[model samples]
Target: MKVFDIIIQAMLSLRSNLLRSWLTTMGVAVGVFSIIAVMTALQAIDRSVAAGLSSLGANTFEIQKYPAAFFGGHGRNRFINRPDITYEEGLAFKRLMQEEARNIGLKVSRSGNQATYRNRSTNPDVVMVGADENFTAANGFDIQQGRNLVEQDILYARNVILIGHEVYTTLFPQRSDPTEQLLRINDDVYRIIGILARKGAAFGQSQDNLVVIPITRYRAHIDSRQSVGITVEASSRSTYSSTLDQAVGAMRTARGLTIRQENDFELRTNESLVESFRDFRQTISIGAFIISFMALVTAGVGIMNIMLVSVTERTREIGIRKSIGAPGATILQQFLLEALFLSLTGGAIGIMAGTGAGNLIAIAFNLPPILPWLWIGIAIAVCSAIGISFGIFPAYKAASLDPVDALRAR
Candidate 1:
């Protein structure tokens, strides 16, 4: 028989058993759909996370009392016991590394504070950052208007502030120029020296909802607490590893750690953050694969049951074809093709549905949608293998029946 004739026959056989074909297809569809949707969503999340980490700048690392990304119950206690990284220590590090490092910045933050200008008041969720003059260069911040805080501003403990895009809009809506506007943080007046360029959102938080002030002024007048974090930037990408080593050494020495004592500080960068994310991703990937495998196994069993019924119902037709000089291989091929057709059709439908659903979820989360081509291709390939593997026993049973015996049995 011609290849086209076999295909037509297989399709016609499926049409005759419309309900059974659809039920079998649904099994495969459900299995593929579950896996594809998960994989696509994960890919989108990974992309968004990578972008967020890169926003911190290349060749940059932070020295902090506590870990940047941590989980579980002891996190609060960890913060409580960890020694505060003082501004004095940060200044000492800056002076020691001034010749080797490009820029070093000291930073502290206060959240859930309201800012007011005239009668306008901002939401209580604004972040107020106390950072040094080099914070703009070290943390990838750019001034959209006016000027950034300079060395003199830090030395003199000036009360000048740079506002984020969201803060600028909320507090100075009527004013055309924010440079001249005065913003009150908890009733403490600060002159706006600059407006920061919009940095969008990261990890579900708005990056442009902050107000930054000189560290000296912030410690003396506003917070009156020790430093929270210290950021250091390498002069060149090639020196990143060496720079990290130097910073760690300087921190250990400044903190008075002995050779045997473990260092209490944490050093983190974009690459390290990505590594942490990978650990989570790997766990999810394994779980997804196991779930998909189980679903496919169930679908394969359904295909086998349906194919057996098809062979039994078509006994007389098989006898007639074999009596007309059809070979056993031909009978086997026909049954296999029928099974393959059902699985491949189901696989296509599942892929389309999964992609649509996953992209919709990604859009809702304000992240870029992903297609997950690798997973889709793998699903198709596995479906084809399932068809051949599960169809074998039924095909063999039909092929082995003698023409006269099959005809006489009914």
Candidate 2:
């Protein structure tokens, strides 16, 4: 018999036990589904976060009291013990980098404040930030209406504020421009001088839900104990690296950190943040791979068991084929093909289902759809190998049956 004939016969044998074949295929399908679903969601989330992080601008870095992110207990304890970055220290650093850096901004933030304009009041989810004149340009925010904060606003601690896109929409739901309007923040009142353009969410947190006021005003009115963060912008793309180095030195000196003592402040740049996210992405990818691997192995085992049963039940038929002068190799090929057909069918079904399910989750999170073609190809190849590996023993057993003994047996 030709190879094609063997495959056809094998398929026919599988058709004789349709339910069992489908069950075996489903096992492999589930394995493919798990990894594909996870990968699709992860890819979408990564894209969304990358776009948000890019909005922080490539020429800027921030100096804060603690690291941008923390790991385990040791990491948390280390940052917790560090002193707060005070507003005075931020000013001193700014002065030291006067000639080297293009712009330096000092800022402090407090969250959970209700903004009220007459009887309309927002939820206590608003973030109120105290920022210097340079904050808007340094942080890559554009003034949509009216003007940005000026030096006089920060120096005199003026009662002026810049409302974010979300704040404007919430306070003035009619979509009217809110410039010059008096916004009541808690017990204090500030005139809105500008509105910020809409900035979407970053890491699942809305960037447009906060309000910005002069840092000097925030220190006097809000809590003075909170640390102030300093944002430094490089003079040019060529000077960015040297500028960062200078800022680091200036900050350490301003904070009075001796050479022997490690610097207590944290410096975060766009590249560093991207590198951190890359590491996190790798960890997630490894976990997904391991989980899928285990599932695929279990499915492969199912294929082996089912194929073994098939060989045993067809012993008499096998003997008759052997008696009719069919080659042992042909018998082996038929059994192996049957197992391969089961695995590949399951894999195809799994790929479709997994891709659809994964993309749906991405849509829910407002992320673009991601199709994992590479993983799909890998899955199909893996399924083929699994089918061959599991089918080998059963194929060899059927091929080795003695014709005389097999014919007399059942």
Candidate 3:
């Protein structure tokens, strides 16, 4: 028989058993849906994270007490055992690296603050970040209005502050502009010297809902303990490697680390952050693939069982075809094609459903929608392989049946 004729016959066979075909297809659909949805969500998250990291500046590096991403489980003493990077230590490093580095920014953050403007109070979940004047330069932040923090502001620990776009909108909605609005942080009032340009969202969280103050004021007023992170920017790309070395060395010296002892602090650059995120994405992809494989395995078994039943029910038809000079290869090809069509149809539907659902969820969270085309292609190929491999035994069984015996059995 011609290939097209065989294909038509296979499709007709599947159409005749609509219920069984649908059930088999449902299994493949479920398997495809599981992985496709997960992959879509993961890709969306990765894109958002990458955008956020880029917003932190390409040549910037940060010194912190903890790593950017930690995967291993921590013991009970993890918290208490970790050493704190003190303000004095940060200052020492800043002084030591001043000659080599272009800019250094000290940062600290406080949460759960209520800002009030004569009764119009903001939500308590607002974040207040204390940073140095160099924060704008090192962190890729642009002022929308008024002016950014200056050297004198950091030196004298000024109460003046810069507000993010969200804060400005919420606190000064009535006014045409928020550059002149005075916001109250806790009990103290601060003039809004500048409004930050909108930086969009990251990891499903808004980046425009923060208030910026001088790090010196933050240390003295909010938290007197230690600095949380220090950002460093190199003057030239040529000095990037040496600058990192100098920064690490300076930090080690400040922390009083001996030759035998390892440095306690973590240093993260933009490239390192991207690498960490890529590693995380890869791990998630592997996990998703394993889960989807298990589901597909079950679906494959279901297909095999259904195909076996189909062969047994069509024994008389098989015998009739063989009696009419139909070859075993033709019978095998027809059955295999039927199985392939069922799986491919199911896979196509699942891809559409998964992508739609994933995009809806991303849209709800205000993130850009992502469709993993590479993964979708892989899913289609996997489904086709599953159908062919699982349907082989039953197709072979049908092809091997004796015409007279099959006719007699029916």
TM for every model, in the order presented, reads 0.82, 0.85, 0.87
- Over 1-410, each residue of candidate 2 has an lDDT whose tens digit, in order, gives 98778878998999999999999999899888888887878778778778766776778899987766556565787788889998888889888998998888888998999898877888898999999989888888888888999999989999999999988888898988788889999999999999999978775467888999999889888878899899888988899999999988999999999999998988887776777777877888898889888888999999999999988898899999999999999999999898899999989988889899989988887677888888888988998998999889998999999999888877
Model 3 residue 360 distance off true place after TM-score fit, in angstroms: 5.7
What's the best-to-worst order under TM-score? Answer: 3, 2, 1
Which sequence of candidate numbers ranks them by lDDT, best first? 2, 1, 3
Native-to-model Cα distance after best TM-score fit, residue 264 in candidate 3, in Å: 1.6
Over 247-325, each residue of candidate 1 has an lDDT whose tens digit, in order, gives 9889887777899988888887887678777877788878878887888889889999999999889999999999999
- C-alpha local distance difference test of each model: 0.85, 0.87, 0.84
Clashes of 1: 0
Q: Pick the candidate with the highest lDDT.
A: 2
Candidate 2 wrong stretches, greater than 4 Å: 1-19, 111-125, 170-173, 184-189, 317-334, 348-366, 399-409
Answer with 2 or 3, whichever has the higher TM-score: 3
- Candidate 3 clash pair list: none
Best by TM-score: 3
| lDDT head-to-head 2 vs 3, winner | 2
